[model samples]
Target: MAVRSWVNAFAVIILSVGQASAESSSGSLASSVKRLTDKFMATGAEGTPPGIPAISVAIGRDGKLLYADGFGQASENRPATAGTIYMVGSITKQFAAAAILRLIEKGATLRHGSTLLKTTTPVSSLLDIANDWTLEGGPPITVAHLLSMTSNLPNFTRRPPHELDPWGAVPAKQLLGGMKEYRPSGYPGSFEYSNTSYFLLSEIMENVEVGGSSRDYHRILREELFTPLGLSDTGFGGDSWEANRLANPHYRRRPRFSQPDWLKGSGDVASSVIDIFKWNKALMEGQALSPQMRDLMLSDCARVDVWTYYGMGWFISHKDGTDRFFHSGTVSGYTSYNLIVRPSPAHWVSVSLLANSDGVEGVDSLADELAELALKS
Candidate 1:
């Protein structure tokens, strides 16, 4: 499977938002969480050979940063820090979803050829999508369906005739030309993981917002979320990211999807744990989206399992006393996981783990462990 397909498809455990009071966090709880995190990193992402070169984690509780840390080397010459920027894979989807919903909420519109269309406009109406994009006899796919991964469209990233090479460059025209024919997978209103869905969502955003001109997802994010949230260390990978400053992806390095225009909004974002935490904090605490939109982002989820739901750009997990919302991603040699777990009504926590290597075993297990620990403490 291609790296982009692994974004939201990798979470295998129950996890969500979390946090505790400052007073309690200053003592044993703080130490406990930190120690637990350190212990996990001690094994270097567990079971992966030439294992994780470096990892950064940011944990929050009650809207406050509880623990922020880094482990291992970012590169031979530098040690990783909480600030080291790593390609944050599919976690980029949340930003895209938020941008779309925020635009929708504010009645944001963009030119689509001769007409102007708003965010709520049907995707079929916004872009030149295939007729087979939806299941037979079903209604045309909408912007909301694309955002929520309920579009039931077959994935283009790993499927035949359109499998993408994330490590190579694909021109915008060639990429769009490939989405011409798609056989629908799964059923309507059911949760099915599809990287192609977000790709379509992003095209809708660009064409509608920028009139489908150039690759401007990075600019869109900066203007909409990063700039407003003060996320200075976050952006798409490339010249914007100084080679020495960005964490060197381990295991598989070089030819590393340098031109990620093909990935687009599906998996092109690179960010730090600190900045990601702030974004999550603002999001969970209502700064990023209105309450109504936040509710939709989370509650629009369709149950795919006993405990997990595929919501708009995130997975909703309600299990083992944890009300969790999260997403995980990978591209080339990086693995990213961001989570929010609420142990109780008044307490919520978010943990973000950014690693330089692709196979970071126990990523979700670590999340579950933290949630279990938070509840017990």
Candidate 2:
């Protein structure tokens, strides 16, 4: 098992590039992208233990692919390609959030009394607080709460070191039962990101849908969110993806870390750069979701800080007087980021960067570099 300390360098950042002319003007930006990509691979290739085998990057500026490249090999034996798959860590949150919204579109609402009650799986003791769970906390724990991460539940990621699982497997139900009994760290209105809350929500989704599986919800997403949006390559766990379309796993201070099967809904979806770009375009164009649902996705769920804002399932940034909606994911050996500017739908861009090494360490810095290059050009 490998552990990431979430050091200062591992933060994910999203920067907005003004609506640059979408003409044939990515030459200089392409060069900068190459420089950043080169820098990352250079460090990894020359690491003390020699970093993982490869890296793949896709950058979209103002809704266009300014640059996409593959560095190193996608697999230890196979050469990496532009479409390689990568484990997009917590970035899976927003996608899960989007799936929840699809349920709402189907007439299922996240009301006060509605929750998943009857499932054979044992719930974790930590989640017992949700047992007597009424929707009394501020705004009822709607699918939105799970999305914005303000349901007042504790984020399992922030748990004590011994309790957190870098690569351990505990029954999902056991973890949920534990959370059920545990008291929330803050009021519902307070901003607290909890993977436990989403886990519970995933269960509830299972109850609402015909089949009791988060995979079913993803199946629905395929129709409501993915297919219509042309995101053929985006899919939940257990899919047969193209060999050339998957990024090899990357780690830091460790050789390999297998992701837990139970963490599927929280962060186990596999995706490609082109797939995310298509998803971003659909989300911006209101193709995957209704205009109303789109607004709900951006609606502020909680205020994390004076500068950083959060909405249902997405992060909002108000910089340079422009508002942007975005999210980032960090999974074992992988780091991913996506951001799209509102109002200026054409000003949409998504970045998917993967390395066969713990590349997320440079997420924020790389995002900054990508944005600067894209916007400046």
Candidate 3:
């Protein structure tokens, strides 16, 4: 299967499993979750190859944190805790998307009658290379297309020598500067998942003047999203002091290199599982965005396949006729998953999982199992 299809299928497998078990009351919710967590940690025992250095899990229901804990070790000696930070990978896209929407909302109220961004706005207006990056006379790409992963931009990281060092820094300008050499794989509205789409969006955020002069996308995220939501433990993983508290990324039971500076808006954010749950609470409570903006962020914009739809930075799915918003991320040595089910018809719940090793056995399945237990509780 294609890589994108495999990702979608894996997600479906977990969500399907979770929903199937949601109605079955096997034991107390806490006990069930603990059992699942135990199963997850067992896979990372001493004998396991590339054992997880740390794993953190958090669950929320109806805007309240239900449980938050960590398993395994953060390092050789330090034990992991709920507050142990980890690179959340593509889950950072949601914060990036929120920053853009916040800018648009702010622009709408400007005294000079500013041109607020809409879904149809041409991406070229914000990113310089979009003007020339086309394939076979395809239509101009739009902001919505990027959000929906339908911009058709080439997946640069997947190019020759597929295993590029994730810790090395690559400037966004340098990345975009090289885009002229590649052509779009599909038309503007075609769904093709690409990290380049989000990296371009990050560049656009940096270029657009919002709340005065332009700032780094990471700053915009902190001011517009993190600060308001009180996500103190969430930010770009750059500070040495904060780094001391972070769970070490590992491969084959050894420490891996650090994250790249260029992963800023796409995946570089380090955050605790508890902070992620807090983010879910703020988002679902309408504290982070206006109702209309929230709807836009959650609304399905493109069909990813038969079972999934892509929104701004979220993957929209349905379980037993209930809407679910989720995204998973896998960088060099970390894997993260975040899921939020809004209230009404659905049993409102949020689950966030962060592990120090990418592709750790049964991590995703454990997340789903924990979600199921949380929802049923």
Candidate 4:
């Protein structure tokens, strides 16, 4: 589960996990809702992935956190809790997207030098792209194309002769530079998920030598998005993660997911359920970007499949009558999910799930179950 940056689902939070429900704030969840969670999420998962032993969930409605809880164990003795931190992999993309928009909104032109960076601007204009890459017929990839996942750039992750070793933690610049060698694998207009597209976007952002805008991605995120939004608990792995109760990677080797360098703007951020809920509320309520840019970011920029559309950092899809805007993340020893559902413009609900193990699909399925019940209740 790299990400659904889609994460595979896992079991519900009803288990032998330390704090399980002892410290959970479940008053807002109706008895019926709890029964529904107990019925579906009730049992099915035996905590298969030995590495993935804990799952935490937080729910928000109308603009407030309605419920927050954890299931399973953080370690042999430690219990996963609402405040438990997990490396939210590609969920980091959302913060990266917000940083880009916020920088643009702060009167800083989205350009590094001669190029006037706008949504319509081509990738060739921003970075020193390879000459061989081509659409073969149509227009070249643009800022909007990259943001919406229409840039058919090759994904180095799935390759026969890997450009950068998928397991090696390279820097963002190295990843982007490696992408220069690969020609366009598909047309520039179709939906294709590529981390290189975002690496390029981050480079473009970093190169924006404006009045005082830092060239660093992490610094930009901390200054522009996290600090301004009051998200103190959300930060990069190696930096701010250890200060809190962290869900360590659960593999036999038990290596940490600390190397986010190559994954910089792509899938390298850590956070908690409570902090995630606050982020979703602030983002959807227009506190993140101006209404115009926010709408564009959430707009159906490109279709992912039959139902899902790729927006800037989120996926937009529909179930029954409700519209959902969300993203998920997966890293070693971790899996994460974020969701916002609109039953109507006036009604809203959000859910954030983080698990310590991988290979479990229940995490994704559990999110669907919880979101549906929350919307109805």
Cα lDDT, all candidates: 0.71, 0.58, 0.72, 0.69
| Pairwise TM-score winner, candidates 2 and 3 | 3
TM-score of 1: 0.84
Clashes of each: 13, 41, 0, 11
Q: What is the Å distance of residue 150 in model 1 from its true position?
A: 1.4
For candidate 4, the clash count comes to: 11
State in Å the error of residue 3, model 2. 33
| Alpha-carbon RMSD of each model | 7.2, 8.4, 8.4, 6.8
Over 101-141, each residue of candidate 3 has an lDDT whose tens digit, in order, gives: 88788772222335456666777666666776543576677
Mind giving the per-residue lDDT tens digits that candidate 4 earns over 1-377?
A: 11111111212332223222323255435343455434433453564433457777887777756567666777777777777778887788788777777766664554445455578767776678645545657777777777877777776555512555655566666767667777665655888887766766678787664574446777888878888887766887776444337776665444432454666777778777877888988887888777788888888888888999999999999878878998877767787889888888888888888888654456656677777666654
Span of ten consecutive residues with least summed lDDT in model 2: 1-10
Question: By TM-score, how accurate is candidate 4?
Answer: 0.83
Tens digit of per-residue lDDT, candidate 2, span 1-377: 00112111111111124233322365555456767777765663334333557766666665555555566777656665555666665666667667767675565523333443221111221133454543344333444555667666656655522454646665556555555555544655577766665666566565454233334445655665667676666776456665445665656645222434456567767776656666766676677678887787777767888877787667887777566777777666666777665435346556666555554455555666676555655
Give the least accurate 10-residue stretch of model 1, judged by summed lDDT: 7-16
What is candidate 4's CA lDDT for residue 333? 76
